[model samples]
Target: MRAVRRPELRLPELRPYDGAELEPEGDYDGLEFAGTDCSGQSARGARFMDCALRRCALDETVLSRARIIGSVLSGVRGVGTDLSQAMLRDVEVSDARLGGVQLHGAALERVVVRGGKIDFLNLRKAKLRDVAFEGCVLVEADFGGAELERVTFDDCTLARVDFSAARMKDVDLRGAAAVDIARGIDRLAGAVISPAQLMDLAPAFAAQVGVRVE
Candidate 1:
């Protein structure tokens, strides 16, 4: 089994970001956005490097096509956060409470999401590499046509997740607390699941293969 590479972040001394409305295409570096309310802020095409956003509200915040590198987003809460087509590398998102977050066509590398509750996450056609979700609850996440590599879910709860047309490689789902697939039950070729999970998904498997268990 190929091991996932974790992010090695060495953040330098950071400056505090002023609580001002985020501007589009803003360039932020080595800054800390703590307790910032970024609701309805549009930072489209922005660049964030070595930054930390702690306890920030991101409701309807638009970060489309933004580049986020070596960042830590913790305790962030919001809904309808738009991160479409964004590029996130070496990022850690912990304890986030997000719903309806749009990450379609985004590219994530070496990202770790821990202890979060995300509902209606839209990752359609996203590219995920070396990403790990630990102890998180993902409800109704849509991964249709996404490409996942070296992705692991450790003690995570995935409910009503749609893997329709998704492609996986080295994806480890053995440590997931629950795996409830709402669609694409037959696309488990490149995933690793435990025997218990296989048993739990037996009905789906049988249905996929047209097996009748009377």
Candidate 2:
């Protein structure tokens, strides 16, 4: 991994100076942490703009009510972090660990989560509009009470994911495996599926009706 460039505090783009180890002591705006270790910290009502967090360990960090825009978080380990009430837009987080990550009441737009084990994630009451999950493992994830509009799951592993009480509109599940689709039946809230997948699930449907469709 390439070394991230340090932010010049005197630059006009970066403001409200806060050290890597020092907490802002209060709500701060436009905080930046590039090429640093900010693990096991609590940042409340903070915002990170144009930050590059490469190879950093943000494990067990609590970033409630925070917003990160246009950030590149490559190789970040965000295990069991609380990112509730946060908004992440135009961010790319690949080769990262997000296990047990809680994103309740958060909104993700145009974010890419590729090649990561996002197991046991809590996305309850979250709004995932225009978000795409590609090539990621979403095992036992809870998407309950979420508003999923125009969400696309492409080539992703969605085993035992929960989407209960979510309002789904125009959700695309094309190219997703059949095993993954079956797990999304009750969890899909009110989302619609393809006709081919519906036809393929005839046997499961028949069994529910007390009929053997062998």
Candidate 3:
């Protein structure tokens, strides 16, 4: 990693923070930042609305108590980052890497994460509404104690993922591969897998139900 420097990127209602790495900073509401690097920094209580974060790296950054409404966070890597108590609405995160990211107590409404690698991502005690995970690889991701409503996992790889104690309503796990479904079923409490998925997960089904496979 090179020396952390804030780049010149402009967004609506957004301004560059001029200072040596801020702590205990204020909020940034309705701001957009493009091609910026806020990596390895801590942004607490920052609120962004109608904002766009293009090609930004928030890796190892601490974003506690932040709220983003209708924002686009494309191509952002949040590896080993903390986003606790954050609220996101109508957000889109594409081509991001969230490996080892922690999102405890976060709330998301109408959020979509596409084409991302989210290994060991933590979403404990999070509340989700109308969230979609599309074309992503989620290995060993944790969703414990989450309240999920209308969440869809479309064409994603979900191996070793845990959803124990998560409240799900209208959640769809259809069209997921057999190995992925097997991992998901390990921690599923209140969810339904499609019949087509059952056929694909025959190996796991046999293992779970004590049925011998010839």
Candidate maximizing TM-score: 1
- Model 1: weakest 10-residue lDDT segment is 1-10
Cα-based TM-score, every candidate: 0.99, 0.77, 0.80
Ranked candidates (TM-score, high to low) = 1, 3, 2
- Model 2 global lDDT (CA atoms, 0 to 1): 0.68
Q: Give me candidate 1's TM-score against the actual structure.
A: 0.99
For model 3, state the Cα shift of residue 132 in Å. 0.9
In the predicted model 3, the residue pairs found to clash are: none
**Where in model 2 is the C-alpha error above 4 Å?**
1-19, 22-35, 178-196, 199-214
User: All candidates' lDDT scores?
Assistant: 0.96, 0.68, 0.72
Candidate 1 regions off by >4 Å? Answer: none
Candidate 3 lDDT over 185-211, as tens digits, reads: 554544567787778767875776778
Across 1-214, the per-residue lDDT of candidate 2 in tens digits comes to: 1111221222136442445562423343444455456678877667767666666777788787788777666777768888888888777777777788889999987677767777788889998766767677788888888888767666776776766677787677764553343333554534555688678656655665578755
Q: Whose TM-score is higher: candidate 2's or candidate 3's?
A: 3
